[model samples]
Structure formats: structure tokens, C-alpha cells
Target: MNKKYLQNFYNQYKVFDFLHTIRQCGIISFWIFLSVLFTTSSSLLVQEYPGKVRQYTHTIEFDYVNWTFDAFWQKFLQSSIRLEDYLPEKQPSGIVREYLRSVRQISQLESQINVIYADPKITDKVAAAKSYQLQLDQFNAYKKQLAPYAESTLQSQISTILSENGLTLIGQPIPPVLYHSTPLPMALIVSPRNKIQQDANISLLADMTAGDMAALEDEVMKNLNVSALVVPIGGVGIYPTMVMSTSDLSFLAETVAHEWTHNFLTLRPLGINYETNSDLRTINETTASIVGTEIGKQVLKRYYPDLLPPESEISTQDTTSDTSNPQATEPEPFNFRREMHTTRVQVDKLLAENKIDAAETYMEQRRQFFWDNGYMIRRLNQAYFAFYGAYADTPGGAAGTDPVGPMVRALRKQSSSLAAFLNQISMVTSFDQLTRMVDNPPAG
Candidate 1:
């Protein structure tokens, strides 16, 4: 929060933001006009080092507020629902439905095009550009054919599940899916450098280049002294609640339900006081993870039964056994959950012991250990754990010794059904509420 450092950080972040805005919105002329306006209005007189005041004619606040994604959503909402072209007999047959088939084709094509566009090997720039446009056009045409049907079917399933579970907050219909993928891998900035502190939240995310993320993270960390993590987010649910068009059908359905859960919690105390209380933030994320997974499975079962694992096998694969030993599994193939859990707990222990440098070294050592075991993690720092350690809905590995995830899971176990679990968790606003609600809990 240092003013001088923030000023330096803002300059770097703003340029990336503007570039991302152009990429996502495709409003080149509009951005060009705005850029020219900002340039003309602002002038750089002198560059000063730390403790010196460097002034600008016009100061622009660098925040995620710039990324409305409004134009994209508005276009999607208007066009995605008017699917009067395809007849019922023309659609595909069986559990692998038409919408799923069409969406998979679109998603794969979109991903391929994105990869092509990012590739630097093409010597014929003009030819490559033309090909990109053609592919994009084809992708859009395909999307237009089935996006509405897909979105409507998915939303209907989500709504039915929510209603059945007594989650009536989503009774009113909302335009919840985007017809096309925006871009890949958005960067988010969380502040204060302390993993446990959650107040005064701020994040900047854009579907920009992966290379840009390293530079951006360094700027945020060295200059602004904040925690930054760039995630390949499947879906984002800020307001309108959107699923990335290119996501696999199963993942797409799950993400849609996941994001909607975020939207649903936004009206409650857990969401309202999200930043003010770190534990509440954990509770909120854990709740979403739990509900989203359950709802996603239900959607798969209803629409794409083939995607759903057999109920008999679910206990073996997905569900953690109530009385299962932690040491029961073979030590091969790198258990990420157990390893990540160890990292979180140890990192906290070191940080608590006033060993800052030791904590960092510990993380790097752990990162190398993971790499040695065939898990290539790019970075392992406080910032990384600070962002990812929130979701504690499911137990083991990531949950580590974090009381929130376990407490939430325990509450779910005590409940009669998924709906009852969600209903009880929704009523919880703080860690204290979780403690009071659960029985035979871990002693503080």
C-alpha cells in the first residue's frame, strides 16, 4: 500500500489491462480512442526514484473495474437464445447429446485457434491472420447454432437442482452462459502479502499472454508488495455468471453450477462480508466447491449419464472414506493433495515461528520435491498459497490442517442430503458459526 510503489505498479498493470481489454472486447477502435484520450490528457514530466514525487496530469486507477466484459455478455445474451434453426430430429442421439457434441467441437476448435494465434512460427503473417479470422467465423457460426440450446438446457438443469435442494435464491432466470470463450488464463492480484489477511480485496484478471504473467507478478510483488496468482479459471461468476464456451461439456456443466453458487452466496452475509473476514471467505469458497461438485454430478447424471461414474465406483474414486487410513495409499504417482497439505501446514508453521526466509526456502524445497516427483509447479511462494488455500470444502491434501474445509465437510456428513448440507452451510457466516454448528470438533 506504499504510495510510491503503488504508483510504479499501476503504470505496468495499466498497460497489460489495456492490452487485455483490446483482446477480450475486440473494441480496437474504442480502445484506440480511449488510449489517445488518456495519452493526450496525461504527460510524464520527470521520473523519480523512491521517496521522490513523480507527477502526472491525469491519474488513472488501475483495477479490475475496467474489465466489464459487458459488450461480450450483452452480445451473447441477445443471440444465444434464438435457436430457431435446428429441428428435433436433426439433433444427435443418446447420452452424448447434440448440444454437448456441438459445444465440444466448438471448444476444441476455439482452443486450437487460440494456440495457432499464439504460435510465433508462422512466417506468413497475413495468411495466418486470414486463417484465424476464417476459423473464428466458423466457430461463431457453430456456436450460434447450438449455444442457446446448450445454455438453456444447462441452466434448466442447474435451476432444477437448486430448487430441489431448497436453494431458492436462483428462482429467477439469469443469462448465465457465454456463447464463446473470451481467452485463457486470467491473472488475479490479492493484497497485503500476508496469506491469512483477507480484508481490502483487489484483483486484476485478463485473458492475456502467459509470458505477461511473470512480469506482472514480479511488478506486483517487488513494487506493490502484494500476493498475486494467475489462474486458468474455468468460469467466472461476477454478475451475470458465465461459463467459458470452450470448456468440456462435463466441466462446462460443473463450472456453470459452480459460478451460480457464487452468485447465490453473494446475497448472503458470507458473500457480503467476504473480504472483511478471511474465514468467511474460506467458508464461501468451500461451500461453492461442495455444492458445485454435487450439482455438476447431478447434471451429468441427467443429461450425460455416460460421463457420470457408476454409483458403486463413486465411493472408491471420489469420496474419501470416513475411516480410511491416511497411510493406506501407495507412494507412487505423486499425491498432490497430501503434498499440498504438507506445504500449507509447514508454511504456516514456519511463518508462525518468525522464520520468513526459512518459510520461503521451505516452499522452494517443496516445489523442487514436487518437480522431482513429476509435478512441475512454476512458482511456490506465500502469494500462491494465499490465494489457493481458501477452498476447504473437500477434505485431505489441500485442506491440510485448515479447520474450515474439514468443518464444512463434517457439517455435510451430518446433513441428510446435499440440499440440507447447502442450506446449513449457507446459514454460516463466520468461523465461530461453523464451530458452534459442528460436534466433536478439532480443539483450537
Candidate 2:
């Protein structure tokens, strides 16, 4: 009845509980493994086609198999430790906050170190970098230590919200709501030059330099006669999910939930048909976006209400002022989504007319325009749209004239609840099915 003896007893009980949980959920895990295997093999098959593209990218392509093995092992160790379980009732939130603060501090130190190296006046650049290296390393170690606990806390929080929304299976979420924050891989998106379509999406190494990305893109485009772009992504929907490391709690929550949604769908017909066609991909991405945003907002409101943005800040208004006093207020801020919508609409039209050169030239001009307006779009072409256009949760942006997104949104509006919307959509195998469902919702 000493502290050490009690702690040992608790640890043994947890092991028993873990074994029980695994015994009950082992089938689900097996299916998830099989689904991931199918998805990865499908991607490899797609990469193999147009073998020249792989020839150029194979050396630089991300080794997801090795990465997954490492990540899964790390996750297994963390699960065994269950560090968050030992925290006081209210301590997890503070731990998460401290972890985020450490992440921000590390980011600041990294920026400062880079600035030091770049300064022409700093003759001893190595020494200058070394000046801040100790602090950076300290913050990095703190972040690493806190990461597992933070991840567990957030996962539990998200799972609770999902359960409240009735997205649970047998009192638990499918896939058990797991995620890991790390440097994410870059995606090389390839599209046909004549049309805007994502024919291939290959993950590349996280540390690949801009020059290497550009060179690989150029080689693929020239060899395959395709429009190619190297783009950064917020998350990848592998098992235990891969999320980009960031200090933004809102984005982190949404991405974790978003990737979980992908795992949820992976066991269903819609996800099974995800790679079958472009429309299905759009539907899948859009569905995940909607679910992620809603669930993320709920998690924030329940645990980190102070961090939530004000209502007025949640969305941008097109109107500059009240109707009675138009001159009373400043002009509306630049809307990225609205402008991107216009660009997409125009590009779609030009591509339809077979004006490839004109479309390319126009996209360049618009890219520059976006840059001038603080958007900093590196490259805006068919591949860019093809890659980004899938996440059509909102009305505008890269979706342009694609009717799929609006239809998905409409279905969500028509459904009784988030769970209902997801259940109805998850069974959909094609856009036609979605269109039919939306057109003729069940009479309630």
C-alpha cells in the first residue's frame, strides 16, 4: 500500500484493460490494415504507370512503408506508456497549451537562427547560429517529451466530440482517433495538360529542397507530357494519421479530425471508390473537410473556448458597410476564396476551349496578381487546381464551377445531423449516387 506498489498495481490493471480492448477491436484493426495495404498498393500501381515519372522521382519519393513502421512503433510505445492517463483532471489542457507554446518558441528560434545565417554583416555565421542552438535544442527536447501526452489528450477530446455527434461505433470511434504530428511529405500532383485533372499524386520526401522539387516536376512534365506541380499538404490519411506540426490549435484539431474521417471512410464504399474517379475524390475530400471543421470547432468550444475566434472573424463579409452609410467603413479585406473562384472559373473555360497557352499565360498573370495581394502563390496551373480543387467544403476557391462540392454541402444541410449526413454519404459509391440522394432526400 506504498506508492510504488499502488503504481505497479495500476500499471498491471491498465495492461489487462489494453489487452481486453485489443481483443474486442482486433477485427477492426485488421480491416484497417488491409485497407491501408490496398490503398498503398493502388498508389504504387498508379505510380508505376508512366514509368518514366517514377524513374525521375523514385530516389526522392517518400518511403511511406518505412515511415509508417517507425510511426506505428512509436505510437505503440506511447500507448503502452499512456502518459496522459496519469495527469490530474484539469492538467491535460495546460500540458497541451505548454506544448504548443514550446512549438511556437522553437519556430521563433529557428527563424532567428536562419536570419542570423542570412545576415551579410554576420561574418561568423556558424557562431551566430550556435548562439541560439542551445535554446532551440532545449525547446525541441521539451516538445518531444510533451508530444505523446498532448497527442493522447487531443485524441480523447476529439473522440468525445465525435461520440457526442453520434459518429461512434459500439461506444468508440472507428480507428480509435489516433494522430501524430510531424513534418509532412510534399505531394507531386500531375495533371493532363489539356484538362485540369489529378491523374497522379505521389508523396515526396519532407526535406526535398525547392530546387529538387522544381527539377523533378520539370522532368516529369517533359517526360510524361503532363502538367506537374509539387505542393505541400496539411495532412496525410495514413493509419494513426500523419499531421503537420504547427502551433495553430484550430488547424491541428481540424486536421486530426479530418484525417480520422478519411480512416472512417476507408472502410466504406465511398472510400473504397475514392480513386475510381475525380468526382468521387472531390466528394471524399469535401466530406472530410466539412466533418473536420465542425468537429474541430466543437473541440475548441468545449476545451479551449478562449482560443476560439470571435463570430465576426469566423467568416469574411463581402459587404464593406451598412446599406445606409456606404462610406462609413473601409473597403472589405481581400477575399482569397472569392478571387480563387474567379480564377478557377476562367481557367476552366479556357481549358474547355482548348486554349492551353492562353490559359497558362492567364494563370501566370493571376498568380502574380495573387502574389501582389499577399497570397504568395508560387505556381498556379492545371496541376495546382487539380490538387487543391478536391477540398471543396466551402463555396469558392479552387472548386470553381464543380457542382460536386455544392451538392455535398446541400446534402449536409438536408440531413438531420452530422452523423446522418456521414452515414448517408459513406455508402455512396459514385457522384451519380450522391446527385440522386441530394435530389431526392428521404421524406421525413
Candidate 3:
């Protein structure tokens, strides 16, 4: 929001905008060509497994092509307007703050509306809903008006941090730090009953109700003989990344950076082989998680220091110790990571011994325990672990006893800087290579 920062941004925007325009043109042309080629060859390339999955989900699946086209067009229009350039100095930050506030208000209104509709005592439900709907409409319109500028402001902030951290090409982040926060589609994860591996992950319609999701999962499981769970995600790694709408600035920043990191890796070997095996997928996700959190923190430190978590909150140690009454210590807080790590380890052991039914029953019991302790996990099964387990950014969670995560963390520890870590890991194509790299550190 500084005057000098705004001026510099305006100056850089012009050059970067021109370059992006040219680059996007070529990319669009290439995609158009591919569309034509794929349309002709689509029938021949359909695989048996995915084809069968599609047969069950074809009616309810999300239309990514149409969504991407609309999103790209909206971004193209936003770029043309150059909303941030026209904003008064110091207004950009305020715009983002107001946008998030508006989102929170909207969320509150939605909750009120839901309560009104759900209350059986409210005889005039329609009338009650109308009052909240009018307020919701106003906030929605205000959010829509402010969205472009807010997005542009955040993008610039993130891009600046990324550039400073040495994640740049020709002084700019490739793909240009673009993201659009909206309602995100739920992913239906499928895995074999005997193992905890994600065999298929399909995107479903965003507006599907919980009952609808359950029904679909049931159908998939019954027909495919696989474990299935529909999970809501924070973001997707498509170009112009799709992020979930949220009022939490920290979460917003981290998710934006996370998806952007995915885009960054897509051009390199590690990302290219993301789907080659479970290890690579874990590597890709863990790497993105690390970069995203660090960059998100930097963005907050520079732009919104007040939002940063206090040192006490960030620290893991219980510094508020009462040494005088050490014998009368309170019960330790429920550690989700440690508990989840235990669950994953036990589940792995059960599945390894081919005790599929027992593993599932155990997961259900664990799910109930988590739910009782305020973690509302709808379903806990092989597919749930298969999907959530890939993000091994931090130690001892759903990753269980997996060595890949620790190896990646070790590599991060060995590298001199964040950029150095990314550069070395981005070129890795397999888990064996990652193991070798971790085992044999570079001589100083």
C-alpha cells in the first residue's frame, strides 16, 4: 500500500502484462490445437478403468473445460481493466481487507439462512429466508465488484515474495501468480479395498449435497469394488488455479501459494512424474506444501504483519510450565498429528496383513474418536487415507511411517536456502533418486 510500492508495481505491471499477453496467446493456440487433436483421438485413447469410472460419474462430474474457459475469460477481462493500476495509493490493501470481511459477512448470512430454513417452528420459512437473501445479495454483489482488485493485489504481493525468494524467470514468476477463489469442486477418491493407494481421483460437481456425495460414494464402492470417499479440497492445481473461497487470510495466502507451487513444478521432472507413482505424488505435494507455507508467511510478514501468528502460537513446546507444581500437570492436549500418525500406522499394518475388514472397522472407530474430539471426519477408510496421506509437508500425520516425507524433509534441511532446495528436488524423477540424494549429501 506504500506510494512508492504502488508506483513500482504500476511500472512493472505494464511490462509483465505485455509479456503475459503474448505468452497466453501462444498457449491458447496450442491448447486449441490440442483440443482438435484430442477430439479426434479421444475414443481410441480411453482407458478401461477410467472409462468405467466415468460411466458411473458422467452425469454428475464437473465440466473442467467449460469452467476453465470461463475462468480464463474472466481473468483476461480483469487483466484488461487493470483494476489495481487505477486504485488510489493505500486503497489496494484496504480493498483486500474489505473483500475478506465481506466474505465473512456472507458466510454468516448463509448460516442464518440455513438456520431459518431448518427451524420447524418457523412457519413462514419463505418470508424469513427472503430477508436474509436480500442481505446476502448485497454482500455478494459487493464481493463480486471487489474480487478482481483483491485478487490482483494478493497476486502481486505473492509474486513479489516469490521473486525475492528466487522463484522467477526473467524477473517474473512463470504463469504469473494467478488464482481465482470460488466454490471448489469435491474430489472423489478411489482406492483398492486391500491397499491405501489412490487409484483414481475424479472431480465432482461443487454443489452436490452431503447426501448426494454419500450416495455417489456408495454407488462407486458397490459397483467398482473399491474404497471411495468424496473429500472437499482447498485448491486445485489447474492453470489460473482454482482455490476455495475463504475468509481466513492465512489459509487464502497459503492455498494460493500452494497451487502456484504445483504450477511451478508442472514444468519440471518432479511434477511431470507426479502421477508415475505414489512416491512422486507425495514428493510433489510435500514440496508444494513447504514452499507454499514459507512464501505465505513471507507475504504476511511484509504486507500484513498483524495477521502473523504470535511466536507463542507458532512454538510447539509448552513454555507455560509450572515447575513448582510439576506433579500436578494438566492432561496433555489432543495431538491430531500424533493420533493420526498412530491411526495411519495401525491401518497400514492391518492392510499389510490383508485384514481389509478389520482395517475399515478400526478406521471407523478412529473416525468416531476424532469426531468426538471435534474433528468432524465424515468417513474414514482406505480412500480417505489414500487421498489425504499424500500431503506429507509436516512430520507424523496421515503419512504414517512413509520414508519419502522424511527424506524430503531431510533434503530441505540439507539445502542452504529454499530456492536451493526447490532447484535440487524439482529435477528428481523418482523416490530412489530422492533417497540417494538424501543419503549422500553434497560435500561442502
Candidate 4:
């Protein structure tokens, strides 16, 4: 892509972010032509679709009040340890390992509890509830043991991985910590009724109803210590958030590393302007995707070898493998990556030619084909692609054709080691830098 085209793409995102910010912050009403300010009058949205269009106008009934210091104190006071008690650690201790195991148990029990509660046939609800509560109580006792060490343990691992990979930790008195956030469902806004545009997204707390809110609430709220534009974040670099309760340790490790990369890159230009530039956003995501996966694999190899993907599965590079143990029952072979890649290329071409109806039809057919192959994808529309297409480093889904992904992957191949690869890529501040570096190699 030419510099002008890249600039145009970035400008589109910048416009959306600016307008969307006004909408989300409940300030658009104060401006003239509220509808025009909030939404584009593009004729594409009004065009006919094969299915009924569900129009969603963003609104903000009430401004979200962030939890104050008193709220933090209240939660902290509930814990046995003080916030300052967790000293920076070089490695995770036995307590960290035990805490993680307990967390896994709790997650499993909680999932079972949900299933039992949902089952209509279970007549002895009270008895089952009591039994589950007892088990939960046993696990919950570890919260005291967990509080002080959880963040430090995760931070240590992230720091060690980055250090090993030849990247310096940015300006911070201590390694970044991880706090488990409440899982929130992020709202994705797409244009053309069903087509996913690169811009237009707002993430409120997952519990907030998009139906009730006008066009304003659906806008991505930008404020202190929050970037609602980034979705499905298991971990965050700023203010250090992590999904500590995930039963899947490998995924948890990946998220820990992923968020750390964001923190590490924040001082660099690429991450600093991540939201404003679409290609930079993709580069950031794809970079983190690659680094995070490698870090996850490294963590498993060193600490939890049993959690590593089996040789058979690793050879195939099918991420959906059972990494927990070497099981007797062989996993049924399914290559969703290759199929999804093909789907993306085909869908992109259709959308490029302005064949919206044909594109939607093709997506549905492809979705069914995937389902028959043991992948259940519910509602594979433009929004699905829009959200998933960003991670181009991974071959699956809508990221197949993204030139940045291939360039980064090529850089990895040319580098002599993991550290060298990361060091070279970390210096990249722009899309052009990536292209130039990939095209020309430095003397060894």
C-alpha cells in the first residue's frame, strides 16, 4: 500500500475514534446535528440485505462512574494482605503454583454449578447447591494465600520472557502486575447493516444492554486507565489486568505475555499510536499474537511441560489440541485454520467487488461447511470478520491476506533466534519500517 492510502486508512480510523469518543462520553447531544455527528449518512447502510437488518443506535442513559479509591480499599480490606505486601519477585514460588491450581479447581466447580443450575430436571437443587458451596468454600480459602503472590508471579514470568527475548522492560518502578477483571462482552459495530468496517466499536461493561442505549453508549469510551476499543483482552498492560481465574493455564500464560508486550511497546511509537493507525493496530496485535504464543509455549516448556501441546499436535500446528495431558483418545483431526483462511480470501474479494448479498450468502455456506467439519460458528457475518480479522499473524479467520502479518512472519524466519527476531521487530515503528526490514536484511 502507498503512503497516501495508508494515511487515508489511518484518517478514517482517526475520524471514527474522534466522533465515537464524543458519542460515548455523552457529549454528542451538546453538538449540532447529533445524528450526523454520531453516524455516517452512507447509502450503503440503507441498501437491501437478504436478512432483516437490526439497526442499533448508540445512546448513553447514564455516564459510567468508575470505582473510586474507597471502592478499591473496600475490596482490598476484604483480603488478608495489603496492596504493598506483594514485593517484586524474580520467579513464581510454590504458593503461586498452588494458587493457580486452586483457581482452576474453583473455575471447574463454578462451571459445574452453572450447568447444574441450568438443568431443569435437577429436583434437589438445595442439596446440590450446598454440596457445591462446600467444595467452593474449600477452594475459596486459598484467596488469602493467592492475593499477595498472584500478580508478582505473573509479572515475573512476563518480565523474564521479555528479557530472554532481548527486549528491555520500559519505565516502571516494578514489573507490571496482573489483576483479574470481570469478563465483559464487547459490542462490535459494523456498517452496511451486516458488513464489518475497520472503525466503529464501543465496549461498555459487558452487562450493559446495547438495546437500551442510544448510539452514544455503543461508542468506545476513552478515559483514564481504560481503552474500551481493545476487545477480548485477557490481560492489559496499563494498570495491569489479567484473567487470573482461567482454567486453561496455557491461555492464561499467553494473555499474561500478550498484555506485557503492550506495556513494553507503549513507550515505542507503534504502540503509542496504536489506536489512531489501523495498520499499526494490526501490527501491534499480530506482534503480540506471535510473541504471546511463543512465551506461552516457553512457560509451559519450563514450568508445566505436561501442559505443552503434544508432538503430534505441535507438528500439525493445530492450536485446538489437548495440551493438558497425553491422552489415550486421539483428538479427531480438524484443520479449521486452512478453511478459515480460504473463507477470508473469498469473502474479501466479494466485498471488494461490492457484492454484499453474494458475500453474505457465501459466508453462511462457509459457516455451514465449517460446522460440518466440527467447528460450530454461530453468526459468521461481517462483524465476526471485523473483530477476528485483525490478528493476521495467525493464518486463521480474516487475517489471511493482511500483508503486515506475512511481513512479520517473514522477519521471524530471517532472524537467527527468538531474541534477535523480537529485538528486530520491536524497533519497527511503522508499516513501512516492517516492509523495508523484511525486504532487506542487516549484515550478521
Question: Which number leads on lDDT?
Answer: 2
For 1-444, candidate 4 gives per-residue lDDT tens digits of 124533444455443466656653443232113223212211122232212122332232111113222223333332322222333232344545676778778888888898888889998876878888788888887654564455545555566666665555363312233344335334443434234445544333444443433333234222111111223435434323334356567888887777666655655667666665567777888888888888878877866777787888666764434446766577666677767878888888888888877987998999899889888775566656666777776555577577777788788888887667766776777889899998889987
Ten-residue region with minimum lDDT total, candidate 1: 49-58
Error of 4 at 248 (Å): 1.7
In the range 139-196, model 2's lDDT, one tens digit per residue, is 9998998898789899989999999999998878987787889999998898998899
Off by over 4 Å in 2: 1-49, 317-331
Which candidate's TM-score is highest?
Answer: 2
lDDT of 3 by residue, 1-444 (tens): 235644665666665577877976776675445333322222222232377677888777776667666777777666655667777777877889999999999999999999998999999998989989999999999999788889988998899999999989888887578788989988888899999998888778899999998998899899989999999999987767789999999899999999988877877899777778899999999999989989999988988898998878765521223236667657766777778888999999999999999999999999999999999999999998898899887877888998888889899999988989998999999999999999998999
Give the Å shift of residue 35 in candidate 1. 28
TM-score, prediction 3: 0.89
lDDT of 1 at 415: 78
How do the predictions measure up, each by TM-score? 0.70, 0.91, 0.89, 0.68
Reference-based lDDT, each prediction: 0.57, 0.85, 0.83, 0.57
Rank the candidate models, highest TM-score first. 2, 3, 1, 4
